[model samples]
Target: MKRRTVLRGLAGSAGSIMTIPALAQDRYPERPIRLVVAFSAGGPTDLMARRLAERLGAHLGQSVVVENKTGAAGTIGATEVARARPDGYTLIVAVSSSHAIAATLMRRPTFDPVKDYAGVAVLGTVPMALAVHPSFPARTLQDFLRVAQDAPEGLSYGTSGAGGIAHLSGELFQREARGIKLTPVHYRGASTALQDLLANNIPIVMDTMASIAEPYRGGQVRILATFAEQRSPYLPDLPTAREQGLPGVVSNTYNAVLAPAGTPASVLATLNGAVRTALADPTMQAFMASNLVDPFPDPTPERTMVFIRSELEKWRPVVQATGLSME
Candidate 1:
């Protein structure tokens, strides 16, 4: 009877001890959380982060502050977040350049995109488009390939920058098409590339749907193909590269939230719940649509990992093929 009593008491003590950690985790975000945007203010990524911070802050009952830590093609902010505490206080607003492409592009990377962080939420995906200035000869994908194959010294396409998703999209497009040879002309930014395209300095430009929306509406540029697995809802009439016969050319960049690896699972669940709730809001839906982002309803860490792995696989071959590396 005495031994049984002792065992029961020990069991009760262990139960209480385990509950303490849960109690602590349940009290997470007692203070404001910092959201790091690895791009400059007024940029697409910063805008998305700020919008999400507002809704997330409201849901968490805590301030979710967005700070721009731009530089090194978004590595500065990413490194800062990767080194922050795993308490879910500091997180990063990651994009394709910072999270997916940088994994294979950077020659001397200080942080590992896969190993150093845990996913909090996936905001949405933005698709890349192949557009030609008004004066370009080809108006359709079939015509564009025919023109490229026979063009003198090959045709050239401008991208926001070398090794960016758009550039990789172009590379993937060329590889999949076999005979379509398109040279890349890297620019300082997408705006500059789009401007050059508008001015007819560049015959072709690979840009995101968000950046191409105005030009596409004004008929200043012809969208030859969208580089997504499916057609964009905003441009449902436009065909994806896959539908146009190049099935291996899906190049999309995602905007997501991530925290330093080892963050408590409870805290991750809280964040994912808040994000999924915000995405389901009608107003939020409108905002994402306006930005040309397709929201992922289920924003879980597992989904984020699957995306990261798949993107790495897709971009790795392109990077190797182009030898696109950064110092």
Candidate 2:
């Protein structure tokens, strides 16, 4: 009798659970939503977040604001989201650096990237190209590798930080190519590294497309190859490193949406729908193109989580192998 009673109780609970989504879909975002960007304002990630905020607010009939809470390689912003109310009002749009390296970088992070947040959607990846000052004399990936292999001190590459995606990608390239030894020069920001690269203080830099495009077009730098799987539409002449024989050289900075863990599943679905709508808007699409960011496909919750997990696994070894840490 007790067993039957328990089974009936379980059926009742499952039926009620099914109704929650219907209830949530009817009325959500009773207040304005906050989208937090882990980095400072005016960068690619920030721009995307702000654009998303405007579109998302329009779709949801509420004001969505983007707040910058930059620090400690995105831990400051992530921690704030992790501790937020989980009422679906607060969201974080972040890159791989925050999700993959924060735990390993910090001596003690306030929150676990995976445990503290639910992966909402991976916006899209921004390609990082291997560029060298035009005066360096390397016109192709092979030529650049050959020179680095021959150099006794190894070739120096500049990146934004010690454990950043750029730093890890540089180390990955070094290991994959085998012959070349790469010495990383960490900078406070891409702009600083770019300044040094322009001055020829650093001959090479593995930097984002947005950062290096102007200089490359201005004849200050030459792009050997982009880290994307295929040649970029914006730079068709430049080959990918993978096509140049280093198949493992695929690297990009991916941005995604994350909400505090245990947020209602209904809220997650709503946010995912909003992301898809925002990314597809013609004006937003034009903005992304101008910025060299590709809009991601299928912003489903499952796909987003799978992509983040894959990225985390992909970079974990590179981080450990390179001995990169925030400390």
Candidate 3:
């Protein structure tokens, strides 16, 4: 009887061990998920994360909470997510600055943008707008160029920070515009940059359309041109830099979702599906449209990874040329 009992006990223990992973897979998200935004609450990245979290929570049947961990050009929050458990509960809103630009710009990057995290879904892409205060002398791109060329010191432009996409776009524009140099005035974020522009502290700014949309519409700021291959649907009348004789000056920033590397494939798939559904919703589309951001053509993890890799490669030389460091 004792020998028979021992055998049964061993069999039960083996069966339980086999069922553990299956149970975890079945109950993927048994709790609320945390979406980390590496920027401040009012920034574009945080806005996108909050909007997506709302619909993602509905689709996943679990609450999705957004936690802002702003600092170090968005690396603080990204590092937090990179070191998180690969259970799909913790994710990060990855941006071009935090992932692509920072990878090369930062002297000592805390996380490997590509290796430390697995792509979940791409939220969208927004073009950088070259805008100026309404009171500024230049109203058109030509006028701005002429002013920049005539000025010995060049035109001053404000950016969110030194190593961000906005700063890079300004640099690229200067390189492509020929004889047009821009003195960069770094601010804490786009909002602050916009504030300085409104106050006439800075003559121009290169920032996301969403950041300047209200001011542009309110007649406080004027958008001279967009840094994109083509005109944005939201600002259809506005011409792109390519159309304005700066062919290679196109720059568009994108936002994406990422999970810690080694996350279960099933969990990643579930998250991707939820993101796709959320992005397709009409309300989400409207929000994106209002912000002058285009929905990503493909929101899948594989596509996101490919896009990220391409971006990283594309920006490596650009960052190197700038010799910008965040150490």
Candidate 4:
């Protein structure tokens, strides 16, 4: 009889403890929620976060505010989110490098990417196009490679940041083209690099289509190829890097949301629902396409994890070759 009583007490305690978080989740978002972006406002990530916030508010019946915590190549913001109270009140919008590349790049990474956070769902990838200045003489990808092979010196290209996707793309292009030598010029952001490209200060730049689409259309820059798996419908006339013979050059900039580790699973489900609702709207799709973002196929937990892991593995070699740094 004593043992039976003891067992019952323990089971009751266990049940209550499990029920607490579930109950709290049911009442979650009784207040405003904070969505942290690891970069400055107006960047691709921030723009997407704001759009999601607007639609998520309608779905959740709560305000989702976006806060930019820029600096240290997104480290400051990521670290903040990792340490936040896991009450579902605070979350983060992360990118490819922030979670994957930063994990290995930073000498003393602030938090473990997989261990310290729970992925919400991927937002999508921002497609990029490789371009050069109009004055560069080579009008074709083949012609450019031929010239690059012949010179292999003083040729240079610009990327958003050192050890970033843009930089890695440039490096991968160099490695694949074999004999095409180019110096990499790193900028704090792609905007800065684009400015130099416009002035003819830099010969080449690998950046997002959204960032350079207008300029390219206006003849301010010459697009070499789109770095996507397939030709973008929006830019249907352009060929993918792979189709142009650079098989290793197709890449995209990814964006996703993640909650601080230990957030209640029930809360996560509710938040996921809001994300799905927002991402499914046709209006959102049009907006993303206009901005050169390819809306992800599905925003589910399983898909998000698979995407992250695949991206990590895909870029492992590039990251190793470039030796990118967070500092």
Candidate 5:
């Protein structure tokens, strides 16, 4: 055969071989799917992941087991999933901390959130609250701002960690609340922060509603404002920061499902469709609302990527302002 004909035959064979895996994905996820959560088993992230696992497993006809590989503010488990095979068997249940805030906040990152993962579904978001010691003398968000602005020194607030979403959200809030600035006093966890706030060791604490819901209800701490766009169901009488004065200071941590970057488009479609269906279930919707987890209107993969990118951009200024860097 001529040289051109031989080259054509070799190219065709290569193309055929390359298409095998993509074609095989038509019957994808034959075995159990591993959903990795980068936090402990009881936290909001883990809870969300487990709920999603049940929904996804029901739809996909496979047990979606949740495995916790906790550490690094959600980068450890994320790294494991980023290195996983792209056969749709391994996925990461990533939060805004890992995918957005940490992507820009951490100086030493384990993986690239945008490059190493493909969006499967945008799970949901939980708005944060700015809580204060009950005796701090602020009845509302505007009152708190006035007190903070008039303070002799920088008012300090507590957060779960330095580079986590809580800290970044606090920083963002400080930036938006002109003439009023609050410094973060980082702790090992939200419980510790709450303890400090209760003891009046710290005047303020910023954390997700899941962490502070009980405290706020029990009157242990006064929620000055929520970062939600509207009223929280749990605190219907309470107004959001936007409702008070600062309109651009809303912040929340969200969960998004992602697969290894090279996963087949067909496999991704299967996973996304299953996730959308699961989240749409009335039971899931009720659960999410009660838990303060708001579902995305459009959770498609394309929209998910755009949302992730926007989150990264949104937190970049906060990171720059706070000068936070995690090990």
Candidate 6:
């Protein structure tokens, strides 16, 4: 009888242990959650974070607060998220520049992109536009390549900054365009680069569609091609580099959500579900459209990790070719 009683106690203990995860998930997000944006407020990353926070709060039954921790090319915010408690309360807005590109560009990486965090979901991707001054003599991507091939040093392209994805895109373009080379000019930001392009000082500028949207729509700048695997839905008429015969010259700035490593699987599932629901909302879709971001077709966490890994591999050689590194 005593042995039976002891066995029953053991069974009960085991069952309770298994129930702990369920109970923890149920009680999760008991308080306000903090979403860290690794960029300045009002930037694209911050905007995405705020938008997700609003919908995530509703889905999780808790308030989601956004905090800006901008610095070190977005490493400051990412480091904080990596070191944060692995309880799902603290999360980060992960971007390709900070999470993937930084790993190869920075002299000393503070965190491991793949190991320090659990990917929640990929929010979306922002494609880069290759724009030029209307009078620069290249109306289409083919025309531009011909001109570049004819006079490799005659054409010059500008990017947002050194060691950025846009800069790397230009590098990749130069390498893949087949005997075509263009001088790279670094600017403070895309807006400044676009300004130069408008002034006819710089013939080409590769920047995000959002950054150059106003100029492109205003007819001040002409976009030759987009650096994406597929054409951007925002501008379907525009041709992608892949379609233009530059197969591997694709560049996209994607944003994702990640929690500190070791976050419970149950909590990760809850967070991923909340993000998926939020992304499907009509309001969210409208916002993303306005911001020039395309919703990721498959946002599962596993896919996000795979995408990040691929991005890291894709940019490593490009960054190395540029021979640039950030302190």
Taking every candidate in turn, the Cα RMSD to the unseen true structure, in Å, is 2.4, 3.7, 3.6, 2.5, 2.9, 2.0
Worst 10 residues of 3 by lDDT: 227-236
Return the TM-score for each candidate structure. Answer: 0.93, 0.89, 0.86, 0.89, 0.88, 0.94
Candidate 5 or 2, higher TM-score: 2
lDDT of each: 0.87, 0.85, 0.88, 0.84, 0.86, 0.88
For model 5, the superposed segments whose C-alpha errors exceed 4 Å read: 1-19
lDDT of 2 by residue, 1-327 (tens): 999999999999999999986676569977899999989998778988998899999999999999999988788998999999877889999688888767666666788777788867888877888999889977899998889878998989999877777788898899889977899999998889989999999998989887788888888889999998777777778899999999998888888998998887888988888888888899988887777775566868778777777777878788878655664
Alpha carbon lDDT at 42, candidate 6:
87
Highest TM-score scorer = 6
Candidate 5 on 1-327: residue-level lDDT in tens?
699999999999999999887677877778999999998998877888888889889998999999999977778888899999888999988888788876676677778888888989888878888999889989998889889989978799999988778888888898898787688899998889989998999989999887888878899989888898787665687788899988997888888999999888899999999999999888888778778786676888888888888888888887877766777
Cα shift from native, residue 114, model 6 (Å): 1.1
Which candidate comes out best when scored by lDDT?
A: 6
Model 3 ranges off by over 4 Å: 1-23, 134-143, 199-201
Tens digit of per-residue lDDT, candidate 4, span 251-274: 788888889888877788888888
Q: What lDDT tens digits, residue by residue, belong to model 1 across residues 1-327?
A: 999999999999999999987887899878999999999999888888888888899999999999999888898898999999899999998888888787687898878887899988888999999999878888789889899889878989999888888888888888999976788999998999999999999999999998998889999999999987788888898898899888888888899889899999999999989888778778888988998997665779888877876777778888888877887
What shift in Å separates residue 140 of candidate 5 from its native position after superposition?
2.1
TM-score of predicted structure 5: 0.88
Query: Per-residue lDDT tens digits of candidate 6, residues 1-327?
Result: 999999999999999999987787788978999999999998889888999999999999999999999998899998999999999999998998998788788888888888898988999999987898989788889999888888935677999888887888888888888687777899998878888889999888989988888888889999998988798888888898899888888899989999999998888888999999999999999999998898787888788788878888888999988898887
Against the true structure, candidate 1 reaches a TM-score of: 0.93
